[model samples]
Target: MALAKPSGLYPCTRSLPQAKTRSFPSLLQPKLHPSPNPSLKPFDATPGLSLVSSSAPVLHLRPRRGFRAPPRASSDPSPLEESPQKDATSEYGLLRRATLVGTATVASKILGLLREIVLAAVIGVGPVATAFNHAAVLPRFSSSFLGGVNGPIHITVATTLSKLSKESRRQLTRKMLNIMFLIGGAFSALTYIYADEIISLTAPGLQVLAQGNLIREMAMNQLKLMTPCILVSGSMAVGFGCLTSEGENTYLALSPSITSIAVIASCAVYILMKGSSSSSLNSPLLGVFISSGASVGSLMQWIIQVMIHKNSERETKFISWMDFFNDKDVHKLFALMLPATLSSGLVQITSLTDLYFSSFIPGAAAGLSYAHLLTMAPLGIFSSTLILPLLPTFSRHTKPSSLASLKENLQKAIVLCMVIILPITCTSCVLAGPVISLLFQRFKFDSSASSFVSSLLLCYSIGSPLWIVRELCAVVFYSLGDGNCPLLINLIAIFMNGILDWLSLSVFGLGAQGLALSTSCVSALSVLALLLLLSNKLGGIINIRDMRGPFLLLLICCAISGFTAMFSYRMLQFFLSTISILRLFGLTELLSILLAGILGMSAFYLPLVFAKFAGVFLVDSLWTTLLNR
Candidate 1:
């Protein structure tokens, strides 16, 4: 699941007043300003107020006083005033917010990792594991694409709500919640009814295996059990968006941990009942428990979000359900939501394609899923902590006069993302085997499984940076009210991804690693295409010529990090080969991993700090702030 980025509706520095001091629910408060000139044409009621018409009458909504817009360039086109101390303070604030979110993300990711580890140990990458992984594709895809914090539904609702008055927000949210619940229910029913057909379509290879009938039956059963999540997940996303719009980010950030914990508890119960021995691992029973746990967890997530919203000062009194259909904002929101939903769906299609291909190779489906979890662990942390907080700033700067600021912010965001992502990519590629071994090489996950997963991880790690870039760039388009661009790009990339997958898997017989490679290649292409189009749209906001220097510097630092990590791991293995103490306690692998990672990061970051490389100031400032805090 992805971290929710702030909708471009509010400035990051602007937050809602305390609930205790408010006369009315904050949901009824309006965040937009009416045009200063009454004679000026009213803007269209499209989400984000993206459509302006001189002849139309603007909505007569009252704007909140004391809410200042972000500063813009002067009429003469002079740059906004900036003092070093003020800039430092602003940077410090951004870093501080990121750290808060990052801390939560780390906790959630650890729990999620534990969930995956438990699943791997209990299930292994066997036929049953592959079946479950395949069965999970649609439910996971729906949850991540439709209901994940950063998914289309959450972003659409948050962005739309940000534009409406508090009263309007409440009415629209209530109606949206109802509508989503109905939609989710209908979809869930369809999925449950067609579970067998869906599983066969997704994992056709399962029908031809030695125990094909058993795997198919297991997968179909799991899919039916998980189908409820299709609905609950969407509802959860809406609740998440509501909380985010109300400025209750802490709860939203930590909510996924609840789902992880639920899964862990469920897994523990099953293990206790069946015992931990490999022979005692009952695939069908375990699959049923895990799938049911996922559905229940999704429901829990939605319930938690609803409870938080109800208790928030932002909550409003219950209004007539008819108010939902009468609201223009609700219609506008769905209009904007449609394209984003399709775009997200297209992204999921790519995942489906990968699974479809991987199913033909024994254990490839499960192996791919395992590798993905490992790859996503760090990606999730950095993307959530760093890129998420910057989204609203990007949104707030989309006006023509603010394009310069947007350009600067975009460049900085890209550089910062690269600084964090590049080294992880490099280090993971070099240390994929050890990392996989250290985290997952116990119990049923044996050396063969480790080797298979590590190969896939290496491919995923290489393309991880591209994935980050693609996501950030897509957000830029979303903020700019050009959702079609990403949708179109995804459509094209999907075709390319399929072709690559076929060539890699069928022609070359590369199996799961081929699927990973195809995904990475397609992601790289998508990033390039997005950059080119975004550059044209912004009248060349990004200059490849200028970015070359920073890109080169990042590459050099990443290379150093990779080499150091690889060298350190080898040295530890060779020197510690004689050390029996670590072996006796089974701490050798763990110690080796920690030492290698620390040394690698030290080698990667120290040079950037000392040499003051491009974008190093972000890390330096964050560190300084951490010390003072």
Candidate 2:
């Protein structure tokens, strides 16, 4: 599965490379202030109180039944012609939604982990697995770029819909859905027909191997089977954008787990039918089965979203060809799609670049896939939960008068990402081997594979914070209605990434680790560029000097947590050998990881709790919930 983007929604971009997982991250903006016209009052926060900022997006907590839009007048303005001053205010704070998102997301992630484990047991990181991963890259990339949650389509829809009247939103959505259907259909056909050529470019190294042709054929077949996913995903994104704009984050957070479940079920069925012998399970046909499962999952997502929309008053209808031609909103949506697609989709494109390089290295493609699965878990959960709710808020407060409040909220968001992600990164880097082994060291997944994936995971972890920061910064630009800045920066980053990939693999000889390393380096550059440009655009809204103290404190705290966890794990491992009860029961590895993780978390949180930083609120809430439970 793709890890949701740091922007706070499910991003298929980080999804599967093994399944060629490509995902779009989610984007949410803040609540809007009441319109001066009595008939046009927007959703509001409770009287005289706001959450985090005056510009936070208002969430529609209660689902309205039979909600009807105001009747259209003869003089009703075209959505494209409307230019209202948008300002958002949240009745509810981020904490409540964050809690809901966190619970659903964490559960989803756990299920995703289980899916990966099942895949490893059935396929291992062998040639078949590598081929499947390679084949999946193209379709997943296309789906995520075009129709995945938080992809350009979703962003454009969510951003645009939030600013429109109910009647306009309903009409616009219908037209958009119809257009996406045609585009997605044509794209799917092209992908299906060109499967061989696509696989050749993405996994050229397969041709050089002894069984290269065999692997290549398998991948081509899998790609053809999965092509329909792109078609279904496009419409799915429109649904997600609609739901997200209406503040239906709970479903958005929960939806991805369905994909994982479908994949797992497919594997279970295959194992049952073919028998569980390693040789029987290694057939290329299993990969095809997995691809079919992914397609089914995509279709299910679209269907469920359609059902949900039909229930909502904002149900979409098929627009006539003439209406499609006449609507200016359709033209406007397409205009936003181009820059947003490039900017939001660079992560997948970058992965394709990395995959092209990886094709030359044996087992490298599969290794990268396995490693990324672990690295993306926390990012998908925390980032989507924390940041996704702020997009509307940012959109509403872009005026000069609200600049200071916007800056403060942005700073708070960045600080929270650092406080949470940094500690987890440190802990993961120190405990990479254990985490990898604990998750995927059974059946067909051997000890050697675990060791290989561990190194890649460590490299991927080093850049986790960079990924979060870059996406967070990008969202700020997007909220400011400046997609061009991120688009331009990403274009530059891609070239830089290619050069670094060449240097890391061809020159430094880092192998698969080199791919992850190059990615981190490129993200760091992008993050810096985004911040500097954002500063220029916002009149120095953010200052490096002001953040230095908090940054340093976080780094120190993370270091301490890492060391403490490492020490605890090692000590536990040592004691496990001497304790007859534990050794006899075979609880050594499990207990060691458990205790170490708990201690590490405690070490990280206690200091920040004492520090009285803004991040403390999150910690305090989580701790309170755990204690009460």
Candidate 3:
């Protein structure tokens, strides 16, 4: 709109004309496309918005003597004066941002891996591991449930931030950050105050380690030690989220790697200085202390984000805490936040359920942690990389332009996750002993720990893809500004998981593996719910029916490959020594897996390649007749 000049008749030459000699740098505006609104009927007479373009006046900062502007006095419009530059981060601009954000996210995931490996080797799934996991998860949970895309509150935030001016936008951002920080602080105190009680509730099985008052006291002390992270990291993440809204993503994307690097470096020094002994609390506690170093790492991240946000937007100013509370944006945020929290929070609670099921047996808690380390690795690497980065992409999209972009992105993301993770999953199933030995053989990770941890790792891997799919669906719902759907889906999963976990433990006697299995099942169900629910809302951008033949073929391939891997591993194992057998078994397993996979592909694709769905008709008929309800 080039915003019309405010009503005025100024003394031009008497003072100095605002436009005269004012620096005029070529402020290349955002390359915006006309996003046609597909949600509304074209025939409807919409007199208002059609005259106005969706794109705003994006002030692209050039390395020049600032912009030559018709500089008005302090009497200028307050909105433009106090707002962040309105630059839309779009899929069209993905390449431009590749170095800044894409590279940074890649770095973060790599660092996260180093962090997990160090934790497993040094901490070995003890109380310290459990404590650190809870502490670290606190901020992440707060971020997800509050401003994260998966939560219901995300819809409101996305819509509000998308619709509002830079000034109004900052108004809400500051308010939301302050309110969430206070809530995080309260949670922090609760975590610290009743740390022992919270731990017991969270991990009933792990409570066996304490005697008399020692247990309670130890849990409380650990909780207190970890509590501040909830406030510090959680509050910092709010700024990160706002920066995201402000179109500055690289700083946050690279922050995880920085945090992990700090933890890894500190832990390496701790391991060298303290040595790897678990006879007393001091050794393990050193790891805990080093783990706390991540908070410091997070601080570095916060500093970077704040600097980037400030540099990106010069008009931003501090928001008053009192004035923030009175704003309608604050009230609307919690309204959105509570339900969104319920949805995303349910997913977080699954970890607690995992803890509950994992603690029932000796070494179960630690074993689950090791398994979770593996599970979270790929998830954190890819899904976290994609979800947050793509959220702004979705926010800018108000049209039904092409689900192809998102579909392709999802397919590639899923395939990438599967490709990177399939080998790990196979190894967990077959080379559990060797893999655990290679990773956590040192310190307190004994033979039993290795076996149980490997089992849990395999079980948890089953849900990894499902988790990503659910995340994608949640993003769709959030982008559409409907948070209740994902929340409802999660609510169902929570109910299903609790039931499934109990049955898995009591009926199947699967122990930690059962907990992992239940999680996998619940996650799959959640993904299904999200797909079904969002398909209806987005008016069927996804074509599940189109992939029916290929999907069946993939399933057939998976089953065949599973059996081949198992049989090949066994045959190879029988013919060699334990050490030599693992190597041979791995080789034969890979060969058999490849062969079976090819057969499955041929079974489905050969027909499609030749334009014949009939090739899989027999299987489809059987599935429809026998499996159809």
Q: Write the per-residue lDDT of candidate 2 for residues 253-287, one digit (tens) a residue.
A: 77778878999989988888998887877798799
What TM-score against the true fold does each predicted structure earn?
0.84, 0.84, 0.69
Q: Alpha-carbon error at 438 in model 2, in Å?
A: 1.3
Ranking by TM-score: 2, 1, 3
TM-score for model 1? Answer: 0.84
Whole-model lDDT values for every prediction: 0.73, 0.73, 0.55
Query: Residue 384 of candidate 3: its Cα lDDT?
Result: 48
**What tens digits encode model 1's per-residue C-alpha lDDT throughout 138-209?**
889777668887788877776666556787677677777777887889999999999989988988888777
Residues 542-597 of candidate 3 have per-residue lDDT tens digits of 45554454456445544544555555556554553346654755554444344434
Compared with the true structure, model 3 gives a TM-score of 0.69
Q: Score residue 514 of candidate 3 by CA lDDT.
A: 87
Alpha carbon lDDT at 549, candidate 3: 45
- CA shift at 80, candidate 1, in angstroms? 12
